[model samples]
Target: MELRDLDLNLLLVLAELVREKSVSKAAENLGMSQPGMSNALNRLRALLGDDLLLRTGRGMQPTPYAERLAEPLNEALRLIHGVVNLEMDFDPARSNRSFTIAMTDIGEIDFLANLMRALERVAPDVSISTVRKGESNLKDELETGAVDLAIGWLPDLNAGMFQRRLTASQYVCAFRKGHALDKGSITLEEFARADHLVVLAPHTGHMMIEHDLGRLGVRRNVKLRIPHFAAVGHILSETDMIAALPGRLVNHSIVPFNLAWAPLPIKLDPIPLNVFWSAKYHRDPANQWLRAMMFDTFSEGAPHVSPDQAVPLP
Candidate 1:
């Protein structure tokens, strides 16, 4: 269909319909009547010559055609919105902007509290929301403006994304404060002999430390596997199962559990913690401020371990 034939307003209806997935809900969001939303949907179907949405037991599901349009449509709308607002200057002190970030449970534990405290003093009107990072779709989410920033050990970001390294993190062995290993430096044999609790990231179903151990032909006696790092502290506090976690996550000042940590006995390269954003928002004033705030917060507060501290197994 020619651009001249299309109603730009219909694109807004389509975007809301795709997001809300229900005509009534989309209408409510757009402040239009249900009949009006249905009429808009009909117009969109005729324009595209495809069924955009279908009814399913779960709810309204996007058809293959609708799914194909979802990303580019959102990106286009975001760009248009950005262009329209390009002249407005961001005043952090007065603006009540909300930012959505994608990160792991570990990141929430290590970064959020401190960052919020800092923002409370400087950008009191701002709000924050967080979503879990999906391994496969993180790049798409950023590009589509679903999330403003992603923070973690995201090593495989897509080419067009911009990343700034926050710090290099190394694994540390953590257990209850009074655990035997806490009395002295842990040895490789002792570490391997202990029952362990491991984290398998929900999106990737991979455990970085386990993968590293496997490569070195060193395996731990893993007794439990969980999907969130937040559970590690509580589990380690009550059970004999220790965990290998990023050092920043076990810092006593931030974590509530009565835990003690030591450098891993086996050598592993430091993982680079990065803040990732799409080049699309690289120069956007609000986005730039948030990125700078994140960089400053993490770089100053999060723990870092130098490469010289990594100890090799015998």
Candidate 2:
């Protein structure tokens, strides 16, 4: 018989029949009817040109060919099963697996230090690596397991992905601690008058803040145009330049940088920061552990929706 004509399920039935050596016993063990098992035995005999098992004085005995095939068939099935299933347990303390996360510079500043500290305590042997966010091939990377997780404002990562909201964030004007704006409420006119430090972080939902400002016709004397949020805290602390930053970032920087922040005069929508993972790895033990760790570390009191409750984008 040609390989294409072979049914994998038939092989399973043949193996069970050969081992049990009784049609009724094999059918009962395999959850099949007696007639079905008998038909399968007939088909197996015709396919292999061997009786395989024959009724003898003791009940059933295998042909010499059947004896040779039995051990090899069981071994092949065992090997195939080993390849298909992953090790179910992921012991963080013992595992040396390295996980990679994709995020922006701001995410690195906000998450990395705390994440590393947590890792040090529980998963000393495990390591972490990070890749820059907004890569054009990021979707492919996540789907193919090149990146284990992604965090931050990833609006474009819809469909075939799962996201858990981390926090509700909004823009706030941040400046040095003793800056005039720190003492009182900020007005749109005063916000426009100050020399601004604008961050041009591409491929993030943060760009919407600039769009809203433009739509409102609020003008700023942009003194510096930077590409990342990592330097914003330092620059704002040393110079008179004030910048609009996510409230979480400003809060994170305030004590260290001696910076102060107030609500922006312009009304803006709250941006939801989230932790995202590929739907492909949603059930993976290691990936599930990482997702739980991130949620515990950064959810900031937000409600968590279960994977079953939270639907993946189409």
- Indicate which candidate wins on lDDT: 2
TM-score of model 2 (CA atoms) = 0.72
Please provide, for model 2 over 174-214, each residue's C-alpha lDDT reduced to its tens digit, 9 standing for 90 to 100: 89999988874677778889999999988776888898788
Q: All candidates' lDDT scores?
A: 0.82, 0.82
Q: Under the 3 Å rule for N, CA and C atoms, how many clashes does model 1 have?
A: 0
Tens digit per residue, CA lDDT, model 1, 130-152: 99866578888999888899887
* Candidate 1 error regions (>4 Å): 1-87, 202-206, 252-255, 299-309
Candidate 1 TM-score over all chains jointly: 0.68
TM-score of each: 0.68, 0.72
Task: Give the runs in model 2 whose Cα sits over 4 Å from its true position.
Answer: 12-83, 143-145, 279-284, 299-314
Each candidate: RMSD: 17.4, 6.7
